[model samples]
Target: MDIIVTIFSTIIDQLQKPTLAFLIGGMLLASLGSKLEVPEPVYKFIVMLLLLKVGLGAGISVRDANLTELLVPAAGAAIVGVLIVLLGSRTLARWKGVSKIDGLATAGLFGAVSASTLAAGMAVLDDENIAYEGFIGALYPFMDIAALVTAIVMAKVSVARRASNAEIAADGTMAMNAAPKTEPAQIEGLEKGLVKTILVDTFRSPAISALLIGLAIGIFAAPDSVYDSFYEPLFRGLLSILMLIMGMEAWARLSELRKVAHAYILYGIAAPLVHGMLGFGVGLIAHHLTGFSAGGVVLLSIMAASSSDISGPPTMRGALPEANPSAYVGTSTGLGTPVAILSIPLFMALAAAFIG
Candidate 1:
C-alpha cells in the first residue's frame, strides 16, 4: 500500500512539466539521438495506463455531471474536434495524394484529444481547488468515439478503393494466381504497410478495450468491486506507463524531424491560438449558462491548450516511422503550455473580476 502511494506520487511528478524546460530536455535528447529504450511491456503498459487514465478520469468526471446544462458544450467541443478531423483530412487527402482512409487516420490522430494536456489542466485546477477539468474529461469519450468511427469508415472505404482501383496494383498480394501480378512489389509494400499500421493498430488498442469496459460499468451500474478495488492497482500502474510511453514516444519524435514540413508551424502557433480562443469561448459560454466563476470558466483552456496534434508528429513516428512528429509535439508543447499557463490565471482573474 505504501509502495503504491509512493509510486503514484513519483509517476505524476515525473510526468509534469514546469515549463519549456521539459521540451528543451526532450529536444536536446533528440539532437543527441540518445537511445532511450523503454521496454516493450512498458509500452503496452503505457497504452493501458494512458487509456485507463483517460477512461477512469473521464468516468469519474461525468459520474455526477449535470448533463442537462453541461452536455451541450461538452458535445459541442467534442463534435467540433471531429469536424476538424474531417476538414483536416480533406486538406491532407488532397495534398498528400493518399487514400481517404489514410487521410482520415492521420486527421483522426490530430482530432483526438491529448490527455497529457488535460492532465496538466487537472493538475493546475486541483492545485487551486477549481472544478473545470472534470467537464473537459466528461467530453473526451465523444472525441474517442468520433475518431474510432472516422477511422473505421475511412478504412473500409480506403480498402474498398484499393480493391477496386486499377492503380492499386496489388499484383503479387493475395492475387487470384492469374491476375497478371496486378500490383507491383513496391505498391504492394505500400498497401500492406498502410493497412497494418493504420487500421489494425487503431482497432486493436488495449486502451480502447479498457475504455469500453469502463463505459459498460458506467452504464450498467457496477458494484464496488468493478469500480473501487477492482482496477485501482491497474489504474495507477497504467498511469505510470502512460507517462513513460509519452516520454519514449517523445524520443522517437526527435529522431525523425526533417520529413515534417509546415505542419510543425501550425501545431506550435495556429493550434494554441485556436485552442485558447475556443477554450475561452467555451469557458465564457459555460459561465453564462452556469454560475461557475471565471477561474472555473477558463479552465477549459487547459484541456484545449495541449494537443494531440502537437504530439501528432511523434505519434506518427511510432506507427509510420516515415514521419517525425516530434517537431510538432515538442515545439507545440513548448509553446502552447507556457502561454496557456500564463493565460489561464489572467483569464480566470479577469473573468472573476469583471464578470463576477
Candidate 2:
C-alpha cells in the first residue's frame, strides 16, 4: 500500500514541477485574454527547436538501439492511429449523434498524434530520467500520417456512401442533398486528383519534413560536438517556452469549448483515456514479445494519448469543409491535449507497475 502511494505521489510531484507550472500559468492567463503573447515567429522558432531536439536526441540514442527491434512498436503505432479514427468517428456519429462530417472530422483530430503532446511527453520522460530508444521519436510520422489519411479517406467515403443512397426525385433527377450528378469519368478523375494532392501535402508537411531530417541525421551520422551543444544543453529550456506558448493557444479556444454539446465534451475528455490505455496496452504486449523497455512502452502510450491539433484540423477542413471546425478544434486543442499532458504521468506509472 505504501509503495502504491509512493508511486502516485511521485507522479503527482512530477506534474507539479515548476516547468509544467508555466503551462498551467499560461492557460490561466490566456483564458482570461490577457495581453501577454508569444509572437507568431517566436513560437514557430521555439517549436522548430523542440522538434529538432527530439529528433537529435532520438538520433543519438538510436545508434545504440537495434532498428530491427523497433518494427513491432512502429507497426503498433500505425494500427493504433487507424483504430482511433475508426472508433472515434463511429462513436461520435452514432453515440453522440453528431453529423457524419463533424464526427469524422473530430475523429481525425483525435486520431492523429499531437506534435506538442509528443514534445510534452518527451519532457516528462526527461524529468523522470526514463530511458527510451531514440528511434521511438521516429514513430511520430507514422502515427501522424496514418491518422490524417484515415480521417480524410473515411470522411470522403462516408459522404460518397450517403450520396449513393439518396432517392431519385419524381422529375428523374437526384435528390438535392445527394451528390450532384456527374459523369463517372469526371468523378473518378476528381477523386484521384484530390487524393493524390492530399497524399502529397501530408507527406510534404513541415513537421513531417523536420522529423525525417532529424531521423536521417540521427541514424546515419556519427556522434559529434554539435549533438551535445544542440540537444543536451538547450532542449528543455526551449521546450518550457514552447509549452507556455501552447498553453496560450489552447486556452484561446476556451469560449469555443464552452459552446460544445455536453456529449461531445465528455467524448473529448474520455477519448484520450481510451486511446491512451489502448496504446499502453499494445506497448505492454510489444514489450513482452519484443523485449522493449518500460520507458519505451510508456512513451508509446503518451504518443497514443495525443491528438493531431497542428496538422489535423487544416487537413479535415480541406477535405470536409462542411464539418464544424469548432467541434474538432475545441475538442482537440482545448480538451484533448491538456488531458493527454495530465495523463502522461499516470501512463508512465502504469508502465512502471506492469514492467517493473
Candidate 3:
C-alpha cells in the first residue's frame, strides 16, 4: 500500500513538470480543434539539437567509462530490444484480427528508441535530481538497430515461409502431412546483405546521423565550452517544445488508430508497461553485475517503453512495404508515446522502491 501511494505521488509530481505539462497542454489544445501546429522544418531542427545534446553528453562520458561497465548494460539493452519484438510476435502478432506484418511493425516501433522520449526522460530525471550514467544515451543505437533488424528479419522470414508453402501446395511437391521446405537459394536471398542494409538505412536516418555526429565530435574534438554554454542550458526548453509537438501529433493520430483493429489499440496501451517492466528486470541484472544506478535502470525502462517516432516509420515503410502504416504508425504515435511518457514516474518509483 505504501509503495502504491509512493508510485501515485511520484506520477503526480512528474505530471506537474513543465515537460509533461506541455505535452498535456498540447493534447488539450489539439482536442479542442486548435489549428496550432509547429512547422515541420522547425520541429526537425529541434529534434536534431536535442539528439545531438544527448549524444554529446554520452560520448563525453564514454570517453572515460570502464569498458566492462559500458558493454554489459549495452548487451542488456540489445537483449531487451530483441525480446520485445519476439514477445510481440508470439502474442500480438498471433491475436485475432491482427495481421502478422502489422503486429511485427508495431512491435518494431515499440522496441526502437524514441529520441524525443529519451530527451524527455532525461529532462524529468534532471528535474527530479535523479543521477544516471551519461553513457546511458550511448545504448540508444544498439537497442534501436537490434529491434529493427530483428523485426524486419522475422517479417521477411515469415513471408518467405508462406511463399514456399504456397509453391509447394501448387506443385504438389510435398505431402499434406510433411513440412514444406524453403529452397536454399530462397533462404539465402531472403537474408542476403539484410543486416548490412538495415545498418546502412538506420545510420543514414537523420536522427541517428545527428546523434552519431555529435558523438564523434564529442570524442574527437574539444567542444566542452560550447557544450556547456550552448546545449546544456537550452535542453529543457527545447524538450518542452518537443513534448508539445509530440502531444499534438499523438492526439491528431488518434483517428487513424481508431480505424485499425481493436487489438492494436489494446496492444498499444499495454505494450509500454509490459515492455518497460521487462527492461527494468534487465536493468536490475545489470545493476547487480556492474553497480548500474537506479536512475540508469529507470532510463532503460523508459527507452523500452518508448515507441520510435522519428526513424521507425520510414524504416518500416522501406523494409516492410506490405505492412499497413496506419496500424504501426498510428498505434505508436497515438497511444504508445503518451502511455510511455506517463509511465516514466511509475518506473522511477519502482526503481526507488527496489534499489533503495
Candidate 4:
C-alpha cells in the first residue's frame, strides 16, 4: 500500500516540478503552432555541457566503485541489446509486413541507447535523491554498438540469402548489379575493415568520448580540483533548458509521424514499452548482482528503454542503404523517446518496490 502511495506521489511530484513544467510548456507551445526553437548551436552547446557534466559526476563517484561489479551487467547489456533488436525487428517485419531491411533498421534505431534520455533519467534520480553507480555511463557505448551491429548484420545476411536464393533459381547465374559477389578472401578483409571502422566511429561519438574523458579525469585527478567548480553550478539548469528544447523537437516531428501508417504508429508505441519492461528485468538482475539501489535500477531500466537518435540512424543508413529513413527516425525520435520519458519512472518505481 505504501508502495502504491509512493508511486502516485512520485508521479504527482514530477508533474508539478518546474523542469517538467518547462518541458510541458514547450510541447504545448509547439503544438499550438508557436515557432519557438532553441538555436542549433546553442542546443549543441547545451548537449555538450550536459554530457560533460554527467561524465564528470560519474567519474567523481567512480573512485569507490568496484570496477569488477560492472563486468556482468556490461555483458548483460550487450545480450539485451541483441535481444531488443531481434524482438523488435521480428515484430515489425511479421506483424506490420514491413520490409526486412526497414524493419531491422527500425529495430536498430530503437534498440540503441539515447544519451539525452539517460541525462533526463539522471535528473530524476538526483531530484529524488536516488543512489546509483556512476560507471553505468561506461556501459552505454557497448550497448549502443551491440544493437547497431546486430541490426546491420541481420539486414545484410537477409539480403545475401535472398540474393543467393534468386541466383540459385536462375541456374547459378547472378543478375547484373544484384549485390556484387566478392571472393572469400576479399570478404574476410572487408569484415576486418568494417569492424575497425565501426570501433573508430563508436568511440569518436561526442557522448561516448565525453564519458571516457570524464572517467579518465575522475580516476586520476585529485579530489576537490577545479573540475568541481564547472559542473556543480550549471548542470540542473542546462538539463532543464535542454528538456524544453527536446519537447519542442518532439512536437515538431508529430506532423511527420502522423503521415506514417497506423501500423507504424502501433509498432512505434509498442516497441519501447517492450524494451522498457525487458530492461527493467535486466536492471533487477544487475541490482541483485551489483547491490544497486532502487534508483540505479530505474536508471538502468531507463538506459535499456532509450533508443538512439544520435548514432543508430547514421549507422543504419550506411549499413542498410535501402532502409526507409522516415520509419526509423520517426519511431526512434518521435515515438520511442516520448514513451521512454513517460514510462521509465514507472519502471523505476516498480524496481524500488521490488528491491525494497
Q: What digit string (tens of lDDT, one per residue) describes model 1 on residues 196-238?
A: 5554554445544655455445544543454466554454445
lDDT at residue 346 of model 1 (Cα atoms): 42
Best by lDDT: 3
Cα lDDT computed for each candidate against the true fold = 0.50, 0.77, 0.92, 0.74
**Model 4, residue 260: C-alpha shift (Å):** 3.5
Please report, as a residue range, the 10-residue window in candidate 3 with the lowest summed lDDT. Answer: 175-184
Q: Give the local distance difference test score of model 2.
A: 0.77
**C-alpha RMSD for every candidate:** 10.4, 3.1, 1.5, 3.3
Q: After TM-score superposition, what is the CA distance of residue 352 in candidate 3 from its true location, in Å?
A: 0.8
Clashes of each: 10, 1, 0, 0
Can you give the TM-score per candidate against the true fold? Answer: 0.58, 0.89, 0.97, 0.88
Q: For candidate 3, lDDT tens digit of each residue in 206-287?
A: 9899998888887778778889999999999988898999999999898997778899889989999999999999999999
Q: Measured by C-alpha RMSD in angstroms, how accurate is candidate 2? A: 3.1
lDDT of 1 at 251: 47
Candidate 3 pairs with clashing backbones: none
Q: What lDDT tens digits, residue by residue, belong to model 4 across residues 182-216? A: 33334455466666666677677766677678767
